[model samples]
Target chain A: MGEIVLSACGLSKKYGLSYALDDVSIEIERGQIFGLVGKNGAGKTTLMRVVCGQSTLFSGSVGLFGHSGKRGLAEARTRVGFMIEAPAFYPKLSARENLKIYCMKRGLPVSENLDGLLASVGLPGVGGKRYSEFSLGMKERLGLALAILGDPELLVLDEPTNGLDPIGISQVRELILRLNRERGVTVLISSHILKELSSVATHFGFIHNGRLIEQLSSKELHARCSDALSLTVDDVEKACAVLENICGCRNYKIFPHNTIRCYDGAVRPELLNRELNENGVGVSSLMREGKDLEAYFIGLLKEGRANAQLY
Target chain B: MLNYIKADLYRIMTRPTFYIWPLLLAALPAAMIAGAGGMYPAGVILAAIPALVYAAFCLMALILTEHTFREDMQLGLYKNDMAGGASRSAVYIAKLITGILLLALLWAVCSLSCIVSASYWLGGDSGLSLLKDMASLQAASLFLRVNVFLAVFQAISIVFKKTSALILVYIAISAAMAYAMKWLGAAWPGLAGFIKHIAGFGAYGNFGAAAGAPHAAGGVALLLAPAACIIVLAAIGSMMFEKKEF
Candidate 1:
């Protein structure tokens, strides 16, 4: 594990009686792009708000840069930058002027390459334009610039690509990758765009109904999603008998119409086909089946709901 | 906290209201002088000027609050400050300080304009003498009133999260309390003395009596009401702010 930059344990926030965040605990190490995936109102934004100190925690502790107490956490936050929800700025003020307010607030010199920073975010030459004049994509780009304003060690962005075109999304993805690779900044980003998130995230956390159901590395997720081998046969009963007795394929599920899917990663498809054929079971179709990020999350949600129902 | 104050001041100056308000304030007296002419003596006119300016000062307090803090909750500026490592108390106090600073600046400008304009346009030593006599007490009264107004408006803004609602609620409560206190005080004489300290409306009589009596007993006695409100309201506001989630 790399050095842990952000950690939250038993975090919960409540509104009236409903829990916005229910005992969510997550840890993001340095140089890791941690992607938070959830449906709307699943507590993704709530968790980000709590971590950024925008909301008070009902119960739990958050440690940033190894700091936990109020003052320590506050001091730790100086090294962090975030952009949660819609990017808000003084509408009448120009983009540069809006950024200058933050610069002054953060004690950065007003002359600190604000135009260069704006240009870096793909907002070149528009720093003098009023914020209200900019399009939604421009606003999102400005938000990204603000998140990286202080060259922070940890960047927390909630739906950074919320209202952007395909080109804009790709640019944001490349920017995140470049920041992580070159500057070694840890990022905790939440997005509904699972495909975009999957492309950039080094780790994933799946949240459902305010609960974090699973957390895993990208490599582990890929392995879990690709391990299934689907097969079809002439006779389901004969194939199952041969697989159980000869091929030793025990971890498998049978579906209707003579189809079976094997979850056992050790079950070699070539060997199983030969064994089934020799045992007088004809093999008709065989292929590897894998889930993309979206399907994997949906399957996880289903399993989570099923387990919840079981208890 | 200092950084917040600095940033807030920068934003405040960017607004057109900051400049428009003072000019508009100065225009009020100019209009009075233009129309009233020699019908009222310089002494009478100059003596009445503080009341006019202070009344406007009260309205200016509300406007300043609207401009400075109206967008805090609406635009999530407080979120930016808190997320940048400022404590809630720090943010609240920073806003308080910013409002107070701007109010003082406006007070200075208005005071100067009234004094200089009266001296220039309203002739004679009588007008100047009248202003000098009432300056200290009026300043004190204005200071206390403006601070109290600012504290109450800020508290309302933070708790309610709506600027228009803040203005309406403040006006409603002030009016309601004034009438209630008058009725209650008339029916029960003993409650008047104690009730006067309970609300800011009780201080209205002090401003008129305080004119020309540089250090009047009424003015000194009225200080306790607003000073206490400033402290209590600020403490409550800060505490509530600390508990507030964004």
Candidate 2:
């Protein structure tokens, strides 16, 4: 419902004869922690690269902060920050020095909130240690710090927690939450860690084989993923009346072809089936199922594969 | 573009290679002074100074151009720069400007060391005369030649990201071309003469030749010719870089 921060439409990129991204369209709104979920080589990094202007020769239109095209995109990107694939810094320079270079390049004053930024990323007192000497988690932290420089409104992070320890991951998660909640920075983060993403993402975009399969808000995803009992019966009108009156179940949906799904977990299928039979609704089939984020993702991919085979 | 230049300069400053190479070259003049110990006449040292500085210029220019942009590319700093709102052309121009500025800084350091050592060991008056000649239009011609060579090296670095491979290819091509020209000159004089004029090093040779002779007309030609080459190569490099992916 907010202003659209990023809109990419009909993006297609190819290497040799293979398409890296094919007709991929994605949109990110203001103050959203949008999670991009996909497997390796599924065009996650490629899409991020194109959006940030790291890669070229792709056919598409990208609008950021209400601007598009070359000059407009460059102007729009002035307010964006990103770290793609891996964190890059001068190994010989210290953390502060590396950040100093970034700040200078962003045309920000060198003395503005640098120490605070480092501390926020849990890199306090790491002044003298060179980047080469730091651990992988430390490097990731520094990369995050660099991406947040100048208080950029939009942050595009690719596999930010790829090499982090548990503690490092939690710390980064907290920082991301604080940045989004307090500073209102919109985030487009990609990762293979589904549980971690499910914990923080306001919205999720599922990409498979270089195509976006689905985009949904957290509420909608949770609703679709919750446990439910799927039932098929004759006379769906009688089944709805029996479920509400006899089974005391109010949360259910009646579909066409006399199919009904009950979302209420406590509703017993045997009791519902008996009630439907008693109400003169012939019960054809009944099944109960539970689905979480992982199962849902696998189901989507499986369904996509099945459809591909059909064509 | 200014921000990109600043970031590049900062990166260059952090790397020891940038300062170490120039310092090593600057120490050469001091070494010459120490070895001479008045064994050779000051006139011989003064005459050798121009060639020594020219060699140092070429060495520093090559080293800086070979390492600066290629290292940044390998580190993926260009991606960071372009993501931070710098256009591809702007990033390319920034690297070119940084290389030129670094070359100037290194050259100044070496030239200063030579001046100081010559003044201390060879006496003040002769050193002043050497400085005067170095400040002349002939020295400007030499600087222009170095710029052209640096631009060529930069273009090579842009096209070929591998540093060692680039160095080998550059040296091989230059040596092969020089040898081929030499052979042709011996075998067929007229054709060889025409090829030499079109060779990439023609302006460099002219500048070097004019350094000793101090011909005004040749100096002017040397100035314009290398400047033109540098502009064309720089434009081509920029276009290629703009189309480059990552």
The candidate maximizing TM-score is 1
Superposed by TM-score, candidate 1 places the C-alpha of residue A21 at a distance from the truth, in angstroms, of 1.6
Candidate 2 has a TM-score of 0.85
Docking class of 1: medium
TM-score of candidate 1's A chain against the true A chain? 0.86
Considering only N, C-alpha and C atoms within 3 Å, which residue pairs clash in candidate 2? Answer: none
Q: Listing candidates in order, what is each one's chain A TM-score? A: 0.86, 0.83
List residue ranges in candidate 2 displaced over 4 A.
A227-245, A248-290, B14-18, B33-44, B123-125, B179-208, B211-218
Candidate 1: tens digits of C-alpha lDDT, residues B41-109: 775776576667767877887888777776777777778777888888988888888988998887777
lDDT of 2 by residue, B1-246 (tens): 888787878778877666777778789987897678479988777767767776667666677775567777877777888888888877777777888888778777877887788888889986787687667666676676677777877888777877678778778877887788889989997666544443345434333346554333555664675677778878988998887788
* Collision pairs in model 1: none
TM-scores for candidates 1 onward, in order: 0.88, 0.85
Residue ranges of candidate 1 with Cα displaced over 4 Å: A229-263, A267-288, B130-135, B161-164, B183-199, B203-208, B211-225
Interface RMSD over true interface Cα atoms for each candidate: 1.0, 1.3
Docking class of 2: medium
